[model samples]
Target chain A: DQQVKQNSPSLSVQEGRISILNCDYTNSMFDYFLWYKKYPAEGPTFLISISSIKDKNEDGRFTVFLNKSAKHLSLHIVPSQPGDSAVYFCAARRTSGSRLTFGEGTQLTVNP
Target chain B: DTAVSQTPKYLVTQMGNDKSIKCEQNLGHDTMYWYKQDSKKFLKIMFSYNNKELIINETVPNRFSPKSPDKAHLNLHINSLELGDSAVYFCASSQVRDITDTQYFGPGTRLTVL
Candidate 1:
């Protein structure tokens, strides 16, 4: 069973626009959520993350918001750039677990 | 310097063959993990080793075995490979002080089985 799910398979947006990607999870025990961006033939790079204690976390142009009651999270990139084009994977870790469960990635294309 | 590196970036082999993929990390992290991405692009954790000790083993088949001789190296060996074994494997490392530690991943190794 997939605990994390990224419903959108692909997304397209114009440069300098805000890009929003959504993710949902079925397991409420997950306490930490992270987003990773991956390019073709390359491994995923850490982007942003949010702890269950907080509702939002921001790193520069990237922001992650978590809603515990809804069992959902989202990543938002403001003023998106072409370099932001990549597949984004949402991952979650249960409390006291060392392994991460990843969702089916969402391919984001930022058009210049 | 590469933080994490994997050898044989692409491998094509016939069914029933045995192959090994080596992974080494220079980040000095104590935890290493193996993840597989299938054709549908679903990434799943197979195994995790911390300080050369087996920590987490998922529901992966017995044909796949993971060995960590040291804290910085983890290798995956597959015996009697099947067609379903074809996928991209990624090696990652992290410092396990807490659950918030970020993991660094290596360039994935793509394996194709005929």
Candidate 2:
């Protein structure tokens, strides 16, 4: 059973526009959520994360919003750049757990 | 200076063969983990070790074994590989003392079983 799900397989957006990636989780026990960006032939790198207690967290041009009641979270990249094109994965960690459960990933293409 | 590194980026072998993948991290993290990404792009955790002790072992097959000689090195060995074993395996590390510690992943090793 997949606890985390990224329904969108791919997304396309124009450069300098906003890019939004969505993720959902079935386990309410998950208290921390994170986003990772991965390029071809490269490992995923940490992007942003939010705790279930908070609704949103922002760093630079990236922002993550979490809704505990809806069991959904989203990553927003404002003024997306070409370098932002990559596979984005949403992961979650259960309460007091160290291991992360990842989603199927969403490939985002930022067209210049 | 790569934080996490895995040897044999690509491996191809027969179904009945035995193979091993090595992983090391220089970031001085106390925890290590192994993850597998299947053809459908679903990433799943197989095992995790903290300070040379096994902490988490998912519902993976007995054919897959993980060893941690030290806090910085974790290796995976697969015996009697099956066709379903073909996938990209990633090794990651994190400092377990912090609750918000983020894991650093390696480039990944792609194993192909013929």
* Candidate 1 local lDDT, A25-87, one digit each (tens): 999889999999999999999999899999999999999999999999999999899999999
The global C-alpha lDDT for each of the candidates, from Candidate 1 onward, is 0.95, 0.94
Instruction: Give the Cα-based TM-score of candidate 1 against the true structure.
Output: 0.98
**lDDT, candidate 2, A19-111, per-residue tens:** 999999999988889999999988899999888889999999999999898999999999999999999999999743378999999999999
lDDT of 1 by residue, B1-114 (tens): 999999989999999999999999999999999999999999899999989999999999999999999999999999999999999999999998876898899999999999
Candidate 2 DockQ, CA atoms: 0.69
Model 2 misplacement above 4 A? none
TM-score per candidate, chains pooled = 0.98, 0.98
- First chain TM-score, candidate 2: 0.97
Query: Tens-digit lDDT track for model 2 on B1-114?
Result: 999999999999999999999999999999999999999998899999989999999999999999999999999999999999999999999987645788899999999999
lDDT of 1: 0.95
What TM-score does prediction 2 earn? 0.98
Residue pair clashes in candidate 1? none
